[model samples]
Target: MRVARTHHRCARRSVVVGKPKAEPRASWVDEETFDAKKKRASLILRRLEKQYPDTRTALNYTTPFELLVATVLSAQSTDKMVNIITEKLFQKYRSPEDYLKAKPGELEQDIKASGFFNQKAKSIRGLSQKLVEDFGGEVPGTMEELLTLPGVARKTANVVLGNAFGKNFGIAVDTHVHRLSWRFGFSDHDDPNKVEQDLMKLFSRAKWFKVSHLLIDHGRNVCFARNPNCADCVVNELCPAARVPAVRKRAKPSPSA
Candidate 1:
């Protein structure tokens, strides 16, 4: 069992920006030739691959259904918190039928520690009900089918498809992925979907699944959203954001001075 204390996201947490979110391109990610950008992306991944060879989703789950629930619970919260909640949660409700049996607001209190419990509870129960009514209680495997579930966006769908189903439909851009993608100059756009597209263009289809996991591991351990540990980052040399700052020009003295 993974202990809550072992998860780095719990040590440092950030709120989730709402979906269809828009974040402007980082100025550091200056315009470059596509070939140049892709090469840098490849080299960064090569170094990070060595740095975080064992990276995987930090959330604990044995089944696709469990992953779905844990991911929905992970929004605006840490994976450690989600794991703690699910440690008991998975034991109590093992199937879609079980979640549908929860009374209104009952599951909310159970998941309150994950934050935004009200919406998260609604999403869980709603998706579980859909799974029972539509998919014969099995979590749908395709991106299209998974998106039909209440809390399943592309990011969530990507996580389920890539990790749980072992299909590389796309890269899952969580907060960590979003931040690191920009820092690594993988994608300039902050919109997760767009960022996913930009990144998909960089790497081959086979490595798509590994991209997010690698970046996320790097983000938690090194390239943080605030005061990132650039000095120790594995790909710092390739990271435009981590480059040594250009010397600032001296300001002209005022005429009076």
Candidate 2:
């Protein structure tokens, strides 16, 4: 009888721990190994392509020079705020020469709503003067030349090159993009340069510009900072950061002794 019981116990143990079960998938990046991670990133890009087919520049501008200036003014300011200020500012200063010729204080007051009036004033004036002297009052297209201008970093240059010139030089890592990319497991690095490198490796060249805009829109509308609406999120199935609440406790009936 003991031998029979031992045999049954051994059978139960075999059933319980025969083969190792696969790890529970908590994130899209975890769905595959390193090589497959790149492929998964491509799939995510495809999903975004359908979601935001018309994804483009949020900033309004007619000319490349206008777009370049607007991108510079967008530093530490929202696109809406910059647009509000630029609506009149653009009408007044039609060209780089006009901006260079205008009084610094007047231009400063004109863009006061966008914040950092003093520094932004200097940047606008200095950048304009450089354009007049160096590029013959035209915004430079290449990344190398664009960086030579004051107040024009990788973020601004990338925005102008991608949106205005339709060039895919690098990814624009805005605050929303940086946060969302990290949450979505696109990158572990906090530095924008490193993040762009990771994204370039994962996504194809065609998605370089569009990917940032899609992520930015999603971050603002859904995955907001401080309080994300993960419950109603579209990508919640693949998101590791989805908020899951604990189940409610139920009262148990007393057992008869």
Candidate 3:
């Protein structure tokens, strides 16, 4: 009886101490998720670059000063509106000296069509004053100096530096750039500066110059703010959140209660 009890105890000890069979470690990610993100970014870059090979600033200007002035005027207005206002304004205010001499009311009227003309006039004048006082009446090339001017922020500075001076300090994250970058899952930040940092990490500096143009063109033509035509888009396959615009068969009647 003693020997049998010992044998039973040994059997129970073996059951408790024996190692469980090893289970295979499952992978968190398969090839599908990895391939999808890669393909999406590639398609987006390729399609956009091909469509707008010559895409650039639409503001018509002959000099760096004009570019600077136009960018300032484009704060809340469209490029088309700014262009129209500047058509005659440029001829009248030929230099920073001319801007300084003009009456505030007169300059306000000149740029009235661009909306918020009064505020814009003040910003432009203030910026021109700084240009004369600090940079000898010339648009500064570096980002640091450009940011010192009135009405100049990182976005404006990036545009002036990249387009006017051919420097790629940072990507210009305008409304279009911001919207497109987020829609494509490139970033989730609400701030333009943060979005720019995210894109800078993903893309090379060599591609920064043309990236804004590509995004602008895409925003205008395909990925519109209200109704994005995802089904017709070239990169729709890779985009997980690509929403196909639903075609309405008939207009719904107003409720008469």
Q: Quote each prediction's TM-score.
A: 0.85, 0.81, 0.79
Give lDDT tens digits, candidate 2, residues 30-71: 555767767666776777677667776667677777777777
* Model 3 spans with C-alpha error above 4 angstroms: 1-42, 245-257
lDDT against the true structure, per candidate, is: 0.80, 0.72, 0.71
Candidate 2, superposed: residue stretches over 4 Å from native = 1-32, 244-257
RMSD of each: 8.4, 19.0, 24.6
Give me the candidate number with maximum lDDT: 1
Model 1 bad stretches (over 4 Å) = 1-31, 243-257
* Tens-place lDDT digits, model 3, residues 122-172: 988999999999999988899999999988888888878887778999988
- In model 3, the worst 10-residue window by lDDT is 6-15
- Model 2 C-alpha RMSD to native: 19.0
Over 1-257, each residue of candidate 1 has an lDDT whose tens digit, in order, gives 12232233342453334332233434545777789888888998999999988877887888888889988988888887889999999999989999888887789889999998998888998999899999999988899999999988998899889878789999888777888776676765757899889889999999999998888888789877767777777776677677443334589888994
